[model samples]
Each structure stands twice: as C-alpha cells, then as structure tokens.
Target chain A: MAIPFSYSLRNLWTRRLTTVLTASGMALVVFVFAATLMLAEGLRKTLVETGSYDNVVVIRKSANSEVQSGVDRAQASIIESQPEVARGTDGRLLLAKELVVLINIPKRESNKPANVVIRGISPASLLLRPQVRLSEGRMPRPGSAEVIAGKSIARRFKGGGIGETLRFGMRDWTVVGIFDAGTTGFSSEIWGDVDQLMQAFRRPAYSSVSFKLQDVTAFDQFKKRVEGDPRLTVEAKRETRYYEDQSEAMAKFLRIMGITLTVIFSLGAVIGAMITMYAAVANRVVEIGTLRALGFQKMSILAAFVMESLLLGLLGGVAGLSGASFMQLITISTMNWQTFSELAFSFTLTLDILWKSLLFSVGMGFVGGVLPAFRAARMNIVEALRSS
Target chain B: MGMGNGKPPIVEIAHLSKSYRRGSQTIPVLEDITFDIADGEFLALMGPSGSGKSTLLNLIAGIDKADEGTIRVGGVDITSLSERELAAWRAANVGFIFQFYNLMPVLTAFENVELPLLLTGLSRNERREHVELALQLVGLSDRVDHYPAQLSGGQQQRVAIARAVVSDPAILVADEPTGDLDRVSAGEILQLMDRLVREFDKTIIMVTHDPRAAEKARIIRHLEKGILTDSDGQPASPVAGS
Candidate 1:
C-alpha cells in the first residue's frame, strides 16, 4: 500500500529551512531558464510579424538579406511589370524598389554606437505594410530629405526625435514623423524617399524589390517564372518565409544559450536537492524501518520521497514563472544576428513556455531525488530499526 | 508444545540460522534456533547485549530472512515467501514496537496510529474510526492532535502501542519497548502489555534486556552467544525437539 501524501508534506514542513533553501536554488535556475526562452520567443515573434504573406521580395540569388542584395532599376522594372503584381487604387503598380543600408547611431541613454537600418522607400512601401501607422507628427514627403523614424528609434536613438536633423552620406535629413510598427522589426528602421537616399549615398542599384501579389495562390508560378528567366539574376520569396528565415539563426542561438545556462545552473540546484534528500533519508532511517514493519512496501517509500522532491520542484517552477511573466513588461533591444541591426522587443511568455519550464524543473527534481530515494527504499529493516 | 491453551501454535521456527559478514569474517548471530509460541502467549526473549535476541525476534516477525531455515507464522511459511509477499504478509499479520517509540515526529498522534491502517483497503472514515478507537484504547484520545515531540516518553510509547495494534495483526513484536523509559513509565508500559495479553489475546514476541520486563511475560526465553538457553543457562531445545 502507498503512504499518504501528507506524510511527505509534513516531513518537508518539518525541515522548512532546507526546503526553502533548496527550492530557492531551483527557482533561480528555472527563472533563468524561462527568461531565456521568453527572450528567444520574443525575438522570433518580432521578426515573424514584420512580414505579410501575400507580398513577395526579389533579391540577388545568393544574398541572405536585403542589405546584401542589389536589384538594378531595370530588374526592378521587370519584376514590377509581372502580370501577377497588384495595382494600387491610383492604377500604379503596388511595388517598392527599396534600398537598405546600415549606419551607426548613438544610443540616447548610453551614447554607445549601435548599428541601425536605414530603409529608403517608394510611396507604395507604407501601403504594403498595413501594420505600420504614424503615431506622432506626419509621414515623410516623397522625393524630399524628410524622414520618418520608427517608434523604437525615436525613443532610443539620439537625433531620432521629430524635427531633429541627422547627417548621413554628407547631407542633413529631418525626422518628420514617428511610426509605430507594433512588435515588428520595421520599428527599428528609419524610412525616407528612395531617390533622395540613392543620390545621397551614390547608389545605382536598389537593394531589393518588394511587390504584392494580385492572387496569393499564383505565387508558385510567379516564383518559377522569375527564377527561370534568363534576364533575371534574382530569387523570389514570400515575405513571411523571408522573415521566418531571418528569425532562424537568432532563435537557435537563444535556445542554445538558454540550454547551456539552465544546464549549468540546474546542476547546482539538483545537487542542492540531492543533499537535502540525502539528509532526510539519513535522519529518517528509523522511521523508514518502522514504516516497513507497518507494511509499507519499498516502492511506497520510494514514491513518498520522490513526491516530496517533485513538490519542491513545482514550488520553484511556479515562482520562476511568476518572475518571468513580469518580464513581459520590459522592452529590451539586441542586435539581430542575421541583419546586424538593433531590434527592440519585449519578453513574450506563451502557454507552451510555461508548461515546458515547469516540466523542466520537475525533471531536475526527479534526477535529484531518485538516488537518495533508492537508498531509503533499499535500507535493511533490521539494521535501520537498530540505528535508533 | 501446547503450553498456553492446548491449541496449535501461531508461530513456528525450525533450524533458523543467520550470520553477518565483516571483512571476510562470518559472525553468526542466530544458529539453528528452533522454537514455538502458542496462540495468545506473551513470550519475552531476554539476554545480555550482543546475544542476538533482537535478531531472533526480527526473524519471527518476518522482518528478516533466515539463512537456512523455515518460519511459519499463522500457518504460512514466511521464509518461503518472496520479498514482496513477505512485506504484504507482515502488513497483514505482524506489528512492531521499537525501543525509542519510533513515532514519526512530524505526524500527530492520531496520524501515527492511522499509518498502518493506510495499508489496508479501509475507507477514510473507517480508518479514522479505527484510529480513534486505538487512541482511546491507549488513553491518548485527548491528545490525538499532539505531535510525537509534544508527548511525553511514556505517552509516545503508548501511541506506538496503539499504532502497532491498530491493524489487529496476528502478532506484535516489540524490541525493548521500555528500555528507554523511566522506572514508572516502564512499569506502566509493562502493565499495558500484560493487559494486551489477558484482554486482547495477542501473541507477543518481545526482546528485552530487562529482567523485570521478562517477568511480565507468560514465558521467558533466554539467548546467549547465538543459541537459545533455558533459565539455568543450558542450551535448550524444548519445543521442537531439535
């Protein structure tokens, strides 16, 4: 027959100091574990939300990012002339042959220089991304030196406020507006007229050409046609697929970092739990013997000890998760590893992360408790009773 | 053979031997011991320190396996049973009382008494009733909620006794039940044990070093240097003709 759960519970309560200390160790490890996963999840969410599925991006075949790709004006025109490209309300092609470049901007608080993306857009560029909206002031005028700063850049970068002037490519540009891109990577960029930027930077080739599809389902045919054309040296990709690829390297790095930190920290926590459990077994040898004589099987004793450790782990898990949930209130920035541009996002906690962290803590507890529990269960009843 | 009530004995041991190995030395603790105790008999095993009396008691209670022998308690050969079966059999038939009370310090007196009943398939209410009755029998009904540390030494032993008999097992084995108690508490514990024999008709096998404690038993068997002896200190094989 199994021992009552109350037995294990009270035993833990009886040693409250050790219980708290061990649980606190586990809590710290779980906190780091959960926070790292949240960081990775937030990064992935920001990049993924930056793109719309119906839009396609055409870049140089071997280029990994827009900053590295170049599409000449002729190629941009050919892509824009495709029959599958959508038309705007003004009967103009719903496409933007954009130029992307990076410049060092000093952070407002630290004055530390960080790489920020400078995107020069056509008039249709803002229309293609419906998620972006002017939260303050007005949009940048076409073919002018005026620029619009994303909300993140406006808040974090020096000379990024409305009406402020920023010097790049030997010309002063005015920040006319601040646009919020709602958790998307676009919020980390500065947008201006493509022709003006191209003249200032002396660039002859557009970095990439983006176009909305008239029919989303015809994307496969359009991609095959673009890739097969002898005149085109570009590859076409759905915007969503492009952004998802952008998130892959950064997400993988975050996961590896989280696993490494959690492993190192959890080793210490598990050892702490092991010490606590071994002490409990040593102190309760006589009690175990008495239980054995009273008819509790070895399995029952093993289960009781393991249950106690699992409870300890559950306590830590809940505490760590609560600590991590509050991290959603914090917005932090880090360099996007793939694009080398500063991106801002908050820690995002999902139901999946919650359950996985809890399961991880409980697994740590099991590893810590099993050996000591075996020692307790495998004790000789005669020798144990005689210990007293 | 039928010393107590002329009925069949509840516990029978034959050719029982046990030893311990210490760095290649085989130290015999119990050797070829044979004995029997009739139903409702209160038997005490008395000896000096290191005389192996407790080992014999453990064997009879099915808490320890014999090296080369058979032990039949309540007509079932316990030595023939596997470890799992022995555990179930012990739960169903054998109760144990320890010298230091061995009460779980974190549990209340009522909870301590309720432990053995948890192994049974009794419902919660049924277990509570059984626990209350056992506490009432031990005169600890007023202190049922008190932890072991809150109770006196004598009260703790009484609680231990209630725990032992709560399941109504066929045999109760106590090792020096009063060895850790004061004289007055020891006297009280002995009187309670004697009452269990006359009133509850329990078959008890107790191992103690106290002569006064042995005097309370219906029959006292002596053990010296791993061998059973009569009162006159001679090697005795009285019951099983071994």
Candidate 2:
C-alpha cells in the first residue's frame, strides 16, 4: 500500500514559513514567464486582427512591406476591375488604393522623436476597415488637406488632436477628427486623402491595392488571376496573412526574450526549492525513521517528498498567473519591427498560456526536488533513529 | 509463570552474529546468540551499554539482518527474505514502540494510530473503527484528536502504544519504551505493556536496563559482550525449562 497523501500535505503545512518563502521565489519566475507570453500574444492579436480573410492585397513583387511597395494608377485600376472583386452598395468594386509613409513626431511627455505612420486612404478604405470607428470629431474630407488622428496618436504625439495642425513635407495638414480602432494596429496611424497626400508628396504611384473577394473560397483563384496578369508586376496575398507575417519578427523576439529571462530566473527558484526540501529532510530524520519502522518502503518515502514539492510549485503557478492576468489593463506601444512605425497593444492572457505556465512550474519543482527526495528515501532506518 | 505454547516457538534465533565496519575496522556487535520466545510470552532483554541488546531486539523485529544463522518467527525463516519481502513481512508481523514515543508530531492521536492500518486494504470506515479500538485499549480514546505535542508524556506513550498495536501484528519490539519518561509515566507505560500481553496475548521482546521494567516480563535474559544468557546470568540455558 502507498503512503497517504495527507502525510505529505500535513508535512508541508507544518513548515509553513519555508513553504511560503520557496513558493514565492517560484512565483516570481512564473510571473516573468507569463507576462512575457501575454505581451507577445497581444502584439500578434493586434496586427492579425487588423486584416480580413476575404480581402486580397496586391503589392510590388519582392517588396518587404506595403510602405516599400508601389503600383501605378493604371495597375490599380486594372486590379480593381477584376471579376472576383466584391461590389459595394454603391455599385463600385470594394477596393482601396492606398499610400503609406513614415514621418518623425515628438512625444508630449518624453519629447523624444518617434516614427509615426501616415496612411493616405481612398474613399473606399473606411468601408473596407469596419473596425475603425470615429469616436470623436468628424472624418477627413476627400481631396483636402484635412487629416484625422487615431486615438493612440492623439493621446501620445503633439499637434495630433482635433483642430491641431502639423507641418511636414512642406505642407500644413490639419487634424479634423479623431478615430478609434479597437485593439488593432490602425490605432497608431494618421489618415488623410490619398490624392492630396500623393500630390503633396509628389508621388506618381500607390503603395498597395486591396480588394475584397466575392467569396472566401474565391481568394485563391482571384490571387492567381491577378498575379498572372502580365501588365501587373505585383503579387497578391490575403490581408490577414500579410498582417500575420508583419507581426512575426516582433512576436518571435518577445517570445525568445521571455524564455531567456524565465530560464535565468527559474534557476534561483529551483535552488530555493532544493534548500527548503533539504531542510525538511534534515529536520524530519526521526519521523522518516519512524515511518520506515512502520513498514513503509524506500519508494514511499521518496514519493511523499516529491509530492510536497509539486504542491509548492502548483501554489506558485496560481499566484504568478493571477498577478500576470492583471496586466491586461495596461496598454503599451512599441515600434513595429517590419514597418518601423508605432504599434499600440495590450498584454493578453489566453487559456493556452495559462496551462503552459503551470506545466513549466511543475517541471521546475520536479527538477528541484528529485535529489532531496532521493536522499530521504536512501536513509538508513537504524542510523536515522540514532540521530535524534 | 512457566509459559510454553506446547508447539514451535514463535521466535527462534540461533547462532546469530552481526558486525559493523568503521573506517577499515570491523566491530563485532552480536556473536553466536541463540534464544526462543514462546507464543504470548513477554520477554525483557537486559544489558549494559554496547551489550547489543537493542541490536538483538531489532533482529527479532526483522528491522536488521544477522550475519549468520537464521531467525524463524511464526514458522517463517525471516533471515532468508529479501529487503522488499522483509518489509512486507515486518508490516504484517512486528510492532515497534520507541523510547521517545515516535508518534508523528503533525498527526492527531487517531491519525497516528491509523498509520499502520493504511498499509492494509481496509476501507476508510473500517480503518477508523480499528483506530478507535486501539486508542480505547490504551485508554486514550478521549484524546483522539490531540496531537503528540499537545499530550503529556504518559498520554503520548499511550498513543504510541496504540499506534504500535493498532495493526494487530504478531509480535511487539520496544527499545527502552520508557527511557525518556518520568517515574509515574514510566510505571504507567510498563503497566500498559503488561496489559497488552496479558489481555491481547501478544508476544513482546523489550530491551531495557531498568529492573522494574524487566520485572513485568514473563521471562528476563541478559546480554554481555554480544552473548545471551539465562536468568541467573549463566550461559546457554533454555527459557521455560525447555
């Protein structure tokens, strides 16, 4: 018969101070691990949700991002007239020929220079991005110098609020409105009329052409037909896929950083667990001897100690995960590695991250307690009884 | 009282020897010791320090192995069993009471007594019944929820005795059971041991230096220089005049 589990539980409870101290150390490491994972997931969710599955974005072949891609006016028209393009309520193709450029801005608090994305959107662009809503003020007028700032941009950068004007590229652009794009990358951008932006910047081409497919399954056939056209020197891709690719580099960097920090911190937690377990073994020599004399086998003693450590890890996992879930209330912004422009997001918690964090904590406890448990099991009953 | 079951001895130890190695030197503890303890007999092993009396009791309890000869307890040659087998055998056969009342400090009197029964296949209710009976036998039934530290020395010893006999083992081995107690506690513990054998018919092998403690046993023997002797301190005489 196996030893009762209460034996291990009561033993740990009896040494409450050391148990709490060791569990807290493990909790710190788990907190770092969980927080980093949440941060990366948040960045990925923001960018991935910025695009739609049924939409196809046409960009210049071999270009890394929309900012670096360009299509002539004729190519944009041809791409918009495709048979697979979905028609809007106005009987026009649901397509937007857009331009993107990066400009330097100074923050209100830090006064430090940061890159902000300035998006020049066609008339159909607002209809295509349903997630973007005008929270305050009005939309920018077409074919005018009136621009609108995203909620994040208005809050962070100078001259980015309604009725403010910013001078750049030898022209004064007035901010006529503020729009909110909930939990998406568009919240970091400033939008204006595409034709006015093109004329002001003296650009003869559009950065990208995005059109919604009539049917989700038609995306493959539409992409092949558009990219197969000899007059078009551009490639087609799903907008969602494109945004996901954009987040790949930053998300990967965050995940690797989280793993590295957690690995380093876990070493300290494991050592703390080992020290606490060793102390328990040392103090309970007589108890172990008494158990052995009561006919408990060596393996029983080993299992009891291991169970104690595992319980400690589980407690730490719960504490750390609770602390990390509170971070969702905090919003953070960083420069998108792919676009080199500001991207705003929040820390997110998911069921997958929760389970993985718990598993990792349990693994640490197993590693820390194995040797001490072995020491406990290998004790000689005759000698151990003599110690006390 | 002349006591023999008119059958094979419950504990038969013959030509048993044991030694310990320290650094490169071999120190002999027990040498060529032989003894027979009858069924339902309460025997006391008396000796000075380093006389190997505790070691002999441990051998009889199956917690230690002999270097030579055999120990046949309850018609089984326990010396031939492996460590795993011996642990199972001891769990079913030997009960241990210690000098310091080796009850688990974290457990209540009831839980401590229930420890051995956990090794059995008894249901939870059945185990509780057994624990209750054991505590009642030791007159500690009212202190069932009391932890070892909360009880007085004598109460603690009674709890230990309850835990030892709770499993209904074939034999009991106590190493200086009252060595750490006051006079009143010690006398009470001795009386409890006497009652265990007299009423429960358990075979007991107790090691102690106290003459008063030995006087409660049906037979008393002495060990000197790793050898067992008869009651008159003579060499190699049969107990119960066998």
Candidate 3:
C-alpha cells in the first residue's frame, strides 16, 4: 500500500515555522551559489562575445594583451598591406591601430579612485566593431579633445557621462558621448581618436593592430607569413581566441571561488536542514509509531521524510534563482587582472546556471535529510508509542 | 456452534516463553505460557503492574518475538514468520489500539482512519468508503475533518478505534484503551469495544487493569508474575501464593 502524498505535505505544513525557517536558510545559501555562478558567467560572456572569429589581431611578440603590446605605425602599415587582409568599401585594408592604457579616476559617490581603461581608436576601429552604438550623444570629432565612455563606465566613474569634463595627465577631455557594446567587454572602455590620444599620452607606438582577414581559412597562412619574417617579429591570432585566452586565468580563479563558497554555504544549509528534520522526527514519534503499527514499511517512512526535505530544498532553489535574476539591474565594476583596469560587468542568470543551482540544492537536502530519516525509520514502535 | 468440523483455532500459543536480558541475567517475562483464542471470542486479560499481561499481548500482536514458542494466529504460524512477513500479516489480520489513542496529530480524523487501509490493496474510492463506514460506526462522521487536537479525549479514542477497524482486520488487540480517559469517556470506550465484539464478531483480546473494563468481556484471564490463570467464573489456584 502506498502512503498518500497529502500526508507528508500536511505534516510539513503543520510545522510551518520550522519549515519556512529551514527553507529560507537554504534559500540564502542557494542565492550565494547562484550569484557566484552568474559572476563567472558574466566574465565568460564579456570575453567570449567581444570579438569576431574571422578577425585577426597582430601584437608584438610575447605579449598577451593590448596593454602589454606595442606596434609602431610602420609595422601597422606593413601588416595592413598584406594580400590576405580584407578591403573595406574604400578599397583600403580593413585595419585599425588602437591604443590601450589605464588611468586612475574618482568614483561617483565615494570619490575613491579606481583604474579605468581608456582606449584610443581610429575611425576604422568603429567600422571593425559594428555592434558598438552611441546611446546618449554623437561620436567625438577626429581632432577634438573629446571622448565617449562605455555605458557601464558611465555609471561607475565621476565625469564619465556626456557633457562632463575629466582631467587626464594635465589635459581636460570632454565627455561628448555614451555608448553601449551590447553587454560585451567594450562596454567597460573609453574611446577617442587614436592620433589625438597618442599625442596627449606621448605614446609613439600603438598597442595593437586589428584587421579582418580575407578568408578565415587564410588565417594559418597569414600567421605563418607574419611570423616567418624576422624583419617584423609579431604574432597573429584570431581576436576571439585571443580574448578567450586572456580571460582563462581570471575565469579559473572565479570558478574556484564560486565552488569553494558554494560548498561552505551548502554545508551550513545542510546542517540547518538536519537540525529541522531531527526536531520533526522527535516531535512526531507517536505519529511514526502509529504508522509502524498501521504496517507502513520502514523504507516508506524513510522515503517520505526525505521527500519532504527535498521539497523544501526545491522551494529554496526556486526562490534563490528568482532573486538572482533581478541582479541584472545592477552594474558592477572590478579591476580586470590582465589589464589592471576596472571592467564593468552585469550579473547574468542563464538557464544552465539556474538548473545547476537547483540540482545543488536538492543534493544538499538529500545529504542532510538521510540521517534523520534513518533514525525515524529505526525507532522502536513501543518506545515511540510510549513517547509523549 | 459449528466446532464439530474441527476447524483450526484462530489463535494458538504453545509453550510461549519470553524473557529480557538485563546485563548478565535473563529476567523471565512470560514463562511457558499456553493459550488459544477461538474465532470471534471476546477475551480480556487483566493483571496488575509487572504481571506480563501487556508482554503477552505484544507477543500475540506480532510486535515482539518470544524466546521460545509457537504462535499461530489466523491459521498462520506467526512465530516462524520473518519480520517483513509478520508486518504484512499483521496489516492484513491484526488491528492495534494503544492506551493514549495515538492518532497522528497532523492528520484529520478521516485521514487517520484511512491510514491502515493504505496497506491494503483497495482503491482510493474503496478506501474512502471503508473509512467512512468505520468513522460512522464510531459516531465520528461529523468530526472526520477535525484534527486530533480539536477533539476531546473520548472522541480521539473513537477516531483511534475507527483507524483500528478501518482495514477490517480479523482480530483486534487493545492495551489499556481507556487508561487515559475519565469515567464517562472510559464507559463510552468500553461500550464501543463491546459493540465491536458483539456486532462485528471480531476476535478481541484486551489488556486492562480496571475490573470494570474487564467485565465487558465474555471471559477474563488473570496473570500474576508471569503465569496465566483462568478466572472465567471458575475456581482456580491462587497464582504464586499457591
């Protein structure tokens, strides 16, 4: 004979205070778990979605990121003249020499200084990234001391939005525009005319040169041709792969942190569930005895209690995931380890992350409830019946 | 009345001896007891504290194992049955009532009554019908939806009785059923037990310290120390003192 599900449900409901308290504690653990995964997901999305697979970036030999690489104008010109480089509508190579540097800027509320990446890009750079769009104002003119800030940066730094002025190295630059890069890494950078920025910062060489290849298949040939020439000691890689490699160390660090914290938090939640289930069994001794006397198998009693705990865990998982989804409303700024500059990212709650969090919650419930359920099943009917 | 055909007794016990091990010594509880209960016989077991009356009832109810014995209940050798088999047999043939009316506090009267039926092969609708009939028999039809906490002690005991009889087991074993109730409640409980035994024709074996409660049974057996003595209107040697 089967025990009705309503019996377990009603029993849980009868102890509403304990049920809710245990569930909420589990919810807090799940929330932290989901948030950590979202942080990792946001980091991955920022790097993976920022560049195209067909586009190739040329940098100085042995350099990993644009901030560490420097290519002179002559070398940039030589790379742009390659036969495998794609041509724009103007019948010229689709190549851009860009500058990447970091400057310390004051935060909006606390006035505490944070390092922010300032990118100097040519007009061709805008053509290279069609996803970039100005959300607030017009793009700055070529020769003017004006800059456009990424949407995320605009929210984090003082004098970052349109119409504000920011001082950088004794020169005041006007914030003329605000742009969005569709939630990618570019959303954390500041853009201006390459030549003007290079003059202001006294940088003679560009950080890196980016260009679209004639055919993705020609990438290997292009890399071979560029590296084979000792006259130009350079490295060429697909921009997407480049950004992927750049994010690997940080992604690994985030994954470790997420898993470690989730384990710790899940331990606390499991302990909470154990305490609640133990109390439930203790209080329902007579009820269990009646069940035994009524001929319910010990396995059934164990299964029923474990199922109740699982239901509670599932409730907590749903709540935590729902709360994490709302975190997209906030914008966070943290220093990018590779560039030592603040990179703005938002919380992302993907379906995969939500499902994983739910599975984790259920596991916690099962692990925590088993001992108590065993104790309940092993109770002596006579002793249990005698219990007040 | 139809005993001329020599049908097997519903309950049979032979040389049943039960003891508990206390440290290094074996303390005997029921020493070489023998008894038989015919089908539909309303028997009561009366004894003082430490008289092994409840222990005998537990052994017959399949809740405990005897140290040495053969116990046949409803024509099945219960003493030889495994723990799992005994539980199934008990579910099908034996009903139990405790002193405190141990109804699940979270369940309503109807759900509590429906519990034993869950161990049966009956469908939900059939279970509902049986539960309804049982509750009706106990006069708790109006209190089916009320929790145990909301009912009086007597009503709770009635619900317990309904639960015990819901599965329609062949025999019922009650231990101090009215021990926790007041005089009026106890009287009502005794009357209900009498109706079950007379109308339902159930083989009832009850343990009680109250002689008034025992008076409702057709035959009352007394236990002193660990020995059983017949007290069914017949002269018997005084136990232990003789």
How well does each candidate superpose onto the true structure, as a TM-score? 0.96, 0.97, 0.93
Model 1 ranges off by over 4 Å: B232-237, B240-242
Q: For each candidate, report its DockQ versus the true two-chain complex.
A: 0.83, 0.73, 0.60
Residues A126-197 of candidate 2 have per-residue lDDT tens digits of: 888899999888988777789999999999999898899976668999999999999899999999999999
Per-candidate local distance difference test: 0.91, 0.89, 0.85
Residue-wise C-alpha lDDT for candidate 3, range B115-135, written one tens digit per residue:
888888888899899999999
The CAPRI-style docking tier of model 2 reads medium
- Across residues B117-193, which tens digit of lDDT does each residue of candidate 2 receive? 88888999999999999999989889999988899999998999888899999999999988989999999999999
RMSD of every prediction:
1.9, 1.7, 3.1
RMSD of 3: 3.1
Sort candidate 3 into its docking category.
medium
Off by over 4 Å in 3: A216-221, B1-8, B232-242
Please give the TM-score that candidate 3 achieves against the real structure: 0.93
Please tell me which predicted candidate would have the highest TM-score against the true structure: 2
Per-residue C-alpha lDDT of model 1 across residues A17-37, encoded as one tens digit per residue: 999989999999999999999
- By summed lDDT, the worst window of 10 consecutive residues in model 1 chain B runs over B233-242
Best of the candidates, lDDT: 1
Give residue A137's error in model 3 in angstroms. Answer: 3.1
Backbone clashes in candidate 1 total 0
Model 3, A249-314: lDDT tens digits are 787788789899889988999999999989888888887877877788888889888987888788
